[model samples]
Target: MNNRFKAVLFGVLLVYGLMLSASFILALFVRFDWISTQSLDWLPFLISLTIMLLGGGLSGFRSSEKGWLSGVLVGVIYTVMIMLYQFLAHDVWLHDGQWLHFITFLLASISGGIIGVQLNQRND
Candidate 1:
């Protein structure tokens, strides 16, 4: 696959994987409300970092010009996935805290994409 395609796929899968894992962890610890973090706060940041580093490393097609687009794409895809899940599960719901979740996700995705592209260029 071309590097751009690989970069896009990596961004999508990395964000998806991290989000799902974070959701699972939240569900697992919902009863205790561990550290008062029942909301999905950490997921987006973590996913963005993972995707930025891993995706760039793997694809080796990083460019500052594409960072914004890539980041936005990842954020949009992740949000849509979350929305779909909320739709599918009748009991599942996003509280007001979810606003923070989406915001963080967008910020993290954008930052990560920028950093990734910068690193890729530097390395080259």
Candidate 2:
């Protein structure tokens, strides 16, 4: 497969993997009452932002070109995957202000891609 495609796929997978890991940890914490249930409110957005950046960085480093585009692809694919899963599994539509998530995630990934490219260049 092409490096760009591979990068994008890997990036999406990485995001999902990290998300699952985060969810599992959160569940454990909640089960133990170590963190209040209210903590679930804004934690997901923060987790997504950081995880997307890491995923985008991996894609940018692997693709080594058009890092912004790779990041965008990663963000889009990841979002679509979630949407599809929710639609198919839960039969749920998006609630209000969900578009903001897409925009925020895309921007985070883009920034990460740019940083990753610079880092890759420095390592070369």
What total of clashing residue pairs does each candidate reach? 0, 0
Per-residue lDDT of 18-78 in model 1, one digit per residue for the tens? 5567667666776576745545576545655564444433323353457766776667667
- Residue 17 in candidate 2, Cα distance off native in Å: 0.8
In model 2, the clashing pairs are none
lDDT, model 1, position 83: 78
lDDT of 2: 0.87
> Candidate 1 — which residues are off by over 4 angstroms?
1-5, 21-64, 91-93
TM-score of 1: 0.63
Question: How much does each candidate deviate from the true structure in C-alpha RMSD?
Answer: 4.7, 1.0
lDDT of 1 at 10: 78
Lowest lDDT sum, 10 consecutive residues, model 1, at: 55-64
Please provide TM-scores, in order, for all candidate models, with all chains considered together: 0.63, 0.95
